[model samples]
Target: MCDTKHCTKNNNNSRNNNKNNVKFIIREATKQDCPSLKQLIIGLAKYESRSLETLPNIEQLEEYGFADQLAKRLFRTVVAQLDGGDGDNNELIGYALYYRNYTPSQGKGMYMEDLYVDSEYRGCGVGRALVAQVAKQCVDAECTSMEWLCYGWNTSSLDFYKNLGAVDIQESLECHKFGISGDDKLAQLANKTVDQQSIKYKIRTGVRDDCPAVREMILKFTVDVKMNLNKVVTLDQLRDDGFGDDKDSRQYRLLVVQLDDSSELIGFAIYYNDYSLNDGKGLWLDTLYVKPQYRRSGVGRLLMSRVASEAIADRCHTVCWGCYAWNRRAIDFYEQFGAINYSLVYDLRLFAIDGPALKQLADCALQ
Candidate 1:
C-alpha cells in the first residue's frame, strides 16, 4: 500500500478525470478481481510482443492471488477503477502488481511486475497515477530503489517512465548461462584443476552463524561500486529461514572461504537452483565477495570454480549474475572465468516530469 501522505501529491488533479467527469479509485485487489487481472496481463503480453508467454493462468492467479504462502507474503496488487468512467459503471480500468526484490548489491528494491491501463483510458493520466502510486509504495517500504525493464521500442512507455524519474541501469545487468550439455565439458575442464593447490584458502559450506560475516563481506563488495547493501536477511532472519521447517529452506547453498590455519573468513559465495523455468534447471550466483586484501589471490577464482562445479552437479543449464558497467575490475575478473556478456543495460534518469524533454535527454549520450 502507498503512504497516504506521499501519494496525496497531485493525485486529486482533474487531469485524471474522464470526459464524463468520472473519477478513479486505487485500492488493493480482491480475489474476485482475478479474471480482470488476467485479462489485463494478457493485454500487456500482447503489447510487449510476448503474447505466447502470458503468465499467471487462472489457476495460478487463484494460488498467488489468495492462497500461495510466498505470494501472500511477498506481494500486493492494486487496481484502478473508474468511478462512472466506464459508461456510468465503476469498473476496473487498470492495475499495478508489484513486489519486493532484494539483492546484496542492490539492497531492498521493488519490481513493478505488471502495470497496464485499458487502451480506452490511455490519455487520461491513468499510467502516471499508477506510477505515482508505486513510487509512494516504494518510499513507504523504505526500499533503496525500484527497477523494471521497458522494451527498447516502446518509446511512449519509456518516455512515460523517464518522466516519473526512473533510472535505467540496464548496462550493468549482466547474465550468463551454464550447465548446458556442451558447457559441462568446459566446466569439467575448469574444475579438474581444483585442488588444495588451486585453492588459496579452505572452502567450507556455510554454517548458520556465518550470516553476519557473509553480510559484511557483501556490504564491502557492493560499497566498492557505490551500491546499497540492504537488510535483506539479518542473522536472525537467516536462522529463522534456514533452520525453520520449510520445504523451500533447502533451496539455497552458501559457502565461505577461510584461511587454512587462521580459520578467518575471507570470502563467501551464494548460489541456488531455481525450477520455475521449464528449461532443465537454472542456477543463480547471487553473490561472490572476497576481502580486498585477499582479492586477486585466487579466492574469487576458487569461489567461481566451486559455483560452476556445483551448477554442473545440479544439472543446471544456466549460472548468471550482474556486474556494474563502471566496475571494470569485476568485469575483467568475470571474463577470465569464461562468462560471456549476453545483454547490455542502459541506465537513464529523469530530473523532471516533461515527457518530451526527457526523451530528448535520453537521445543524448552522457558527457
Candidate 2:
C-alpha cells in the first residue's frame, strides 16, 4: 500500500457517462461501490469480446467482497470514480481487482486479475494510477513481484508494459511476446474421432483403488517440477483429501487416461469447482500430468479433453490453470488448444504466504 497520503489523487482529464469531463479520484473501493465496480467488470468483458455469463452478479460481488464481518477476506478492489456527482450517478470509471497467488518459486506477491477502464476513461491516467498504486502496495506487502496477464494481441498495451519493463511469462521473452478454450471449440476437440491405427487411450473417472496410482503420479509430478515433497503431505493425507466422502471438505474430480490394452494410468487431470464473486461456476484445473514416457502420445490431450468436456457439461463458465514459466513444451501444447496465455509479454506471477509466515499470521493479533 502506498502511503495513503501519496496514493489518492485526482486525474484532470477524465471522462464520465455524460461525456462531460470529470475529475477522476483513484482510491480504495468502498462497500457502496460494488455496483459500479461490477458494471466496469461487465464493460471490460464486452470490450474484450467475452460473454457476460462468465461474471457474477452485483449482490454476489457485494456479499463476497464487502461483507464486513468475514473472518478472512479473499479479495480487494480499488476504483477510479468521479470525485463529485449529483444523484446516484457517481460513476466509477475504472477499477482493479486483485488477490494473492502462491508459487513455490516466489513468496507472497500480488496478482492483478482485472483492471478495466471505461472507454472514455482510456488515455487518461486512471489505468496507470490504479496499477501504480497496486505496485506500491505489492512493495509494501513485502512481495517479491506483482504480476498480471495482458491480452496477447493488444499491441498498444503490450508496448505500454514493455516501457514498464515487463517480461513474457513463459519464455522470459520481453514486452511484445504474448484460455482455456471456449466451450464450443472444446466440444469440437472432444467429439472428434481418433485414428484406429494410432495409439489408443481411454479416460475415466478415478476410483478409490486408483488412489495409490494417483499418489505415485503426484510424487512424480513433484520431482518433475524439481521440488521436494518434504513428506509434509503424506500419501494417506493425499488420498483422504481427494477420496474422502465428507461433504464439507472440498470435493475434487479426477480424470485418468490409460492405454486400451493395459490398466496402467498414463495421465491424469484433477479439477474442482471454483466459484468467485467475479467468476461464477468456474473449473480450477489443479494438475494435468502425463508420465514422461507417455507424453505427446495424446494421453495429456485426452485428459485435458475429458476435463474440458466435463466442464462444459457441468456448465462451468471457464477453466483456469497455470504452468511454470520454464515449461515451454507444456506452454506450446496449451497454446495449440487456444488456451489464453495471459500476458504474452510478461510472465504473470503467483504469490504466496506460507510456512512460518502462515503460522505467524495465524497467531498475530490486531495492533
Candidate 3:
C-alpha cells in the first residue's frame, strides 16, 4: 500500500480488516476533497519535520489531479470520511494515494504513494482501512505487487508496514532516486544547445534493408547487458515483424542512427504503439542500443531524441522504457529526458508463459 517515496521494494497482502465495524466511509477522492487532502498533506509534511512550501500547491494539485482535460495526475487517491463513526465526523480525516508502475521485472504494478490518518483518528482503523482499499485496487489493477516507503526513524509507521508484510528491499539493493535532470521536453530537445558533433548524425526511419545491421547490433546489445544470446533472429524475421508491407502483421517500428559521413549505423531504437484504456496512447521503447565504439559520442542521445520526437508526433501521452539496474550510465542519460525510473519499486516479477505452461493452462479450460 504505497506509491513513491523512493520506489524501494514493498511488502504486500490482500486482506480487509474492517471486522471492528468502523463507521468511517472510504471512497475515491474528488475535486471537493482537494482542500482537505491538501491540508492533510501539509500536516503530514510538518509531522515528518518538513514544510508545506516544499510541496505542490493547491492549484497545481487540482490541475494535476482533478482537471477534466489534460490532467497530469500521477496517482489516484481515496479518502476516509464519516457516516456514523467517531463524533459523527463528516470531514476528511484520512487518505491514500497510489499510482501504476512498470519495470523489466514486474511487468505492471501499483505503488501506494501516500497514506495518512488524521492524528485525532489514529489507531481507530482509519489507516488500515485506507490501506485495505489500496490493496483492493492492486488486485483490481492486476499489478504484480504493491510498494511504498517510510521514514527510517518512524518506528510506528514502520511497525504498521511490517504488520502488513512489506519487505525492505533497500537493505539488500542499493536504492537510488533520480528526478528528471533536464528541464526541456521532447519538442525542445532538438533545438537545445547540444554537442557540436550531434549535427553530423542522421536519424532516419529504418527499413527492411537495414535489418541485417540491426540484427548484428542486437547480438552486441544482448551481450552488453550480460544476457545470453539464447537464439539469434534472422533478418527475414525481423523484416516480417517490423517492416512488412502487410500492415496487419507488422507490429513495431524501428529507427537507426548513422554517421552522415560514413553512413555507418551506430545506434538503434525499436518501438511499438501501446495503449491503456486509462492512459490513452503511449509509446513503448522496446530496445535502445548503441555500438560499443559509439559510447560517450552523443549517438545515444541523438537516437533517443528522434524516438521522442516520433512519440510526440503520434500524440503519445508518455514514453515508457526500462534499463538494467546496473546500467547507471543509461539511467543517467534517461533522467536528462525526465524518465521516471521504477526499477527498484515493487518486487519485479515477469511471467513468461512458455509452451508447456500454455498447454497446461489451456488444458484447464473445458470446451
Candidate 4:
C-alpha cells in the first residue's frame, strides 16, 4: 500500500502550475478498489475491442484478487490515483495487474496481465509509473525478468514499452502467441484422444526423481528451439521447487510422456495456473517439448491433451503458450485443437526484459 507520487506535464501546462497541475500517486490496490477496478476493466476491454461477457463479476474479482486465502488470490494490482493535493479529489486513473511465473532458465519472473490508463490521463506518465511499481516489485522479489504481451499494431505502446527498456520477444526471440479459450472449445479439446501410433507411450505426472531427466530434456528443448540455455535451473533446485514439502508453493506443474516399453522419458510439458483480468482463471504452458525421435508419434499432442484436460477440470478459461512462427509443425498441431493464433489475428507480440536490461529498469524506479 506504499504510495509513490509523480508529477507530469498536463495538456494545460500553460496555466498557473498550481491550478491545472496534474499529479498522481501509484500504490497497491485494495479490496475496496474492486468496483472501480471492474469499471476500468470494462473500459479497457472496449478500447481493446475485446468482449467483456466472459469476465468474472466484481465479487469473483474480489475473491480472485484480495481474498483472505492465499490460494484464492490469483494476482496483485497497483493503481495510479489522481492526487490534486486535496485528498477528497483523489480518483483512480489506471492500474496494472500482474502475477508471478517461473522460467527454467530465469527462475522467478513476473507477467503483467493487464495495464490500463483512462483515456483522459493517457499521457500523464500514469502508465509508466504503474509499470515502474511492478518492476520494482520484480527486483524486490528477486525475479529475473518482467514480461507482457502487446498488440503489434499498437506502435504507440510498443514505443512506450521500448522506452522503458523492454524488448518485443517476437522480434528478439521470434516467437508468437496462441491461446485456446471458451469452455466449449476447451472441453472439446480436453476430450481429444491422442492417436498414439504402434509405438506405445504413457503420459503421467512427473515426480521428484524425474528432475534429472527433466533437466536433460529442458536443455534439449532449448537447443531444439535455437535458444541459448542461459542461467538454466539446476537439478536440485528444480526438484525442490516443484516437489517441495509445501505442495501449494510449487512453482510449476509437470506432465511427462514416457515410452511404455523402456520407461524412458521422451517428452514433457511444464505449465502453471494463471489468472488475468480478461481471462479470469487460466493456465500458462511454459514449455512443451518432445524428443526428435518422438516428434510424429503423437507424444506432443498427448502431453497437450493432458494439459488441456487438467485445465478444464479446474474450470480454467484459457490455455496459452508461445512458439516460434517458423515452427509450422507445432503451430499446425495446436491449430488442430481450435487454438486461436492471437499473434496472427490480433498481431500480438510478447515483450520481456531480463538480465542487464531488467536490472537497469529496476534501478530506474525511485528509491
Candidate 5:
C-alpha cells in the first residue's frame, strides 16, 4: 500500500509552489487603468534611459487615454496585469500598443507601434504573450502581415524579432530631406521661402504620350539600383497592354509630376490595385522618381502628398512601396509623411524561362 501521508504532503508543496510563481492575465485596457498604464510607461521610459523631455503627466494621460479621438482611432493598448493569486492586488506588468499600418503594395499589413515588458517580467513569457496577442489582433483586423522596428543596439530585441520572422530593413538606403537639411542646403534653397516667390507645381493624370520621357527618367534613376522594373512600363504601353482587347490584365493609373511654370515632367508614379489572396485592395507605388536637380524642391513631397490623397480618393486600403536599405534619407522622409515600412521584399529576382521543361522544373523547385 502507498504512504498516503507522504503523497499528500508532496501534493500540498507542489500547489504552494505553483501559487508563488508569477501569474498574469492580459486584457483590454480600461479608462480606469490609466494611472497604472502611466506608471508602466514611465517605468519603461526610465528603463530605456530616454530623456523625460516629453514625459506624459496625469493630465496628458487623461487626454490620451480618455479624450483624444485621434489617439483612440490610431492605436489600441493592451495591458498585462500580474495577479499574485488568491485575489491579491493586481499590478500592471507590461503593455503592447499597436495600430494598423497598411502597405499599399502588399495589401493589408499592420505594424506594431510599441511592445514593452517590465524589467521584472523580462525573462518570463510575458513579452512573447504580448506579441502573440498583437499578432492575433492584426489577423482579426484582416492584416496580411505585421512588422515592427527594433533598435540596432538592442541585440536581444533584434534576436527576438528575428526569431518571430521579422526582417530588418536597415540595409536599404533612405535618402531624405535631401535639400532641406545637412549638406544638401542647395536642395533646400530650391524651395521658396515665405518671403520669396513660391514656385507652383502642376499635377495631372499621365497619358500615353508621356511614356517615353517617364520611362527614360526611371531608367536614369535606377541606373545602378537593384530593382526589378519588369512591371514598370511606359504609359502608352500600360494603357494599351492593361486595358487592351483582353479584359483580364491588371488595371493601372499613372500620375505625372510637372512644374507649373515650364510644364516639364520631373517625376511619375505607376500604381495599380492589388487584389490578392492575402490582401484585399492596396496601391503599389510601382515607380516614383524625380530628377536629381529637382529633388528637395518640394517635388518629391508634393508628388507623395498628392499620391496619398489620390489613393484615399480611390478608396485604397493602403499604399506600399520599397526603398533600398541604405537609404536613410528616403526612409526619414517617408516616415515624416506618415508612411511606414511594414514589410521587406528580399532577394527579388527577374528571370525568363525559355522552355516548358525548364518552367516545370522551376515550379517544382519553388514547391
Candidate 6:
C-alpha cells in the first residue's frame, strides 16, 4: 500500500521553478478521489482516441476498487495532487492504478493498469513521481517486477518510461493479446470440448497439494521455451503465497489438467484477475503449458476454454497474455479463440522493470 505519511514529493529547484513553482505530492487515493480519478481516466481515453462506451461508471469504479465489503481490494490507486492547496480544493494532476500479477518465473509482480497525468501538468515530474511511488510500493511488498503497456506511437511516453529503466519486451517477443471474451464468443470456444476418446483428462481447480506438479510443469515450460526461470522461484513460495489463509488475497489462481486414467498432471494454467481503466476487469493468463505429446490434442484449447469460463464467472470482460513472435502454433491457437493481437492491430508494446533495474528504481524511490 502507498502510505500517505511516507509518500514523497519532488521539490528540487528545477521542479520548484517550473510553471510558477508548482508543487505536488503523490499519495494513495481514497474513495473521495474517485470522481477526479474518473475524469482523468476519461481525459486519458480522449488523449488516446479510444471509445468511452466501456468506461466504468463512478459507482462501479468505487465498488470495484474501494468497496468496504471486498475481502481484498481489487487494485491500488495513487494520486498526484497539488501540495498545500486549500483543504478539499487540492487539484489532482495525475493518478496510477495497479494490481498484483504472478508468474512462476517471477514469483510476484505489479501490473500498472493506468498512469495518466492531466495535460496541463505534463513535464512537471508528476507522472514520474506517481510511477516512483508505485515502484516503491512494489518493493515494499517484495514484488519482483513491475510491468505495463505503452502505445508504440507514443514516443514521448516510451522515452519517459525507458528513462526510468523499463525495457520494451516487445522488441524481444512478438506481441500481446487481449481476447475479447464476450458471452457468445466464450460459449463458442467452450463448446469445442476436447476429444475424450483420444485423451482421458479432467480439468479442475488446483490446490496446495498440486503445487509440486505445478512447479514441475513451470520448470519444464521454461525449459521448452528456452527461457530462464527465476532463481528465487520455489515450490514453497508457490504453495504459501498462492494458497494463503485469505483465499481472496492469493496472488494467482490455478487450473490443472490431469489424466483420468493414470492420474498424471499433463497441463496447467495460472491466471489472475487484473483491471485497466479501459478494459475494467479481466484475466491475465500468465502461463498455460501442456506436455509435448499433448500438443494439438485439444488440451491447450480445453485449458483456454476453462480460462474463458472462469473470466465469465468472475464477470471479467477480457483475457490477456503474451506470446513469442516465433511461436506460430501458439499464435494460431490464441487467434482461433478471438484473441486480438494488439501488437499487430494497435502496435502496443509491453514494458517491464526487474532484476537490477527494478532494484535501482525502488532504491531511488526510497531515497
Candidate number of the best TM-score: 6
lDDT of 2 by residue, 336-355 (tens): 77777654423443323233
Root-mean-square deviation of candidate 3: 10.1
Clashing pairs in 4: none
What's model 5's TM-score?
0.52
Task: Give a tens-digit lDDT track for model 1, residues 206-233.
Answer: 8877877777777777677675456445
lDDT of 5 by residue, 1-367 (tens): 1122211112211111132255666667777887887778778667656655656565655544455554223346777777556657578889876555432233344455567888876755566556656666655554456655554556787777655445454533331111111112212322323211375667688876776677677667666364445434444554564345554332456788877778589888766543211122345565678888777777777676566666556555556665665776777867665454543322221111112322222221100
- Whole-structure CA lDDT of model 2: 0.63
Q: Which consecutive 10 residues in model 4 have the weakest lDDT in total?
A: 8-17
Candidate 6 is scored at a TM of 0.92
Question: After aligning candidate 1 to the native by TM-score, how far in Å is the CA of 74 from where it should be?
Answer: 5.1
- Which regions of candidate 2 are displaced past 4 Å? 1-55, 59-178, 196-200, 275-279, 345-347, 362-367
lDDT of each: 0.60, 0.63, 0.62, 0.81, 0.54, 0.81
The alpha-carbon lDDT assigned to residue 329 of candidate 3 equals 81
Candidate 6 per-residue lDDT, tens place, 1-367, comes to 2223333334431123244466776678999999988899899999999999988889878988998865546788988887655665478889999988898876888989889999987876677777877888898889989999889999999999998889888886654655655567766766677676588889999989999988988898888677777554798899977899887668889999999888689999998988877777878898999999887888898999898888888888778887888888888888888878877788888999987777666654423
Cα error, residue 334 of model 1, in Å, equals 5.0
- Per residue, candidate 4 scores C-alpha lDDT tens digits across 171-211 of 97678889998888888877778677687988899998888
Better of 4 and 6 by lDDT: 4
How large is the C-alpha RMSD of every model relative to the true structure? 8.3, 8.6, 10.1, 4.2, 13.4, 3.7
Cα deviation at 182, candidate 6, in Å, is 2.6
Off by over 4 Å in 4: 1-20, 84-86, 195-197
**If both were scored by lDDT, which would come out higher, candidate 3 or candidate 5?**
3
Backbone clashes in each candidate structure, one number apiece?
Answer: 6, 17, 10, 0, 25, 0
Clashing pairs in 3: 2-111, 2-112, 2-113, 3-111, 3-112, 3-113, 11-166, 105-349, 106-348, 106-349
Angstrom error at residue 12, model 6: 13
User: In model 1, where do residues sit more than 4 Å from their true spots?
Assistant: 1-22, 68-74, 84-90, 104-106, 170-193, 196-208, 226-255, 259-262, 270-286, 292-320, 328-367
Order of candidate numbers by lDDT, starting with the best: 4, 6, 2, 3, 1, 5
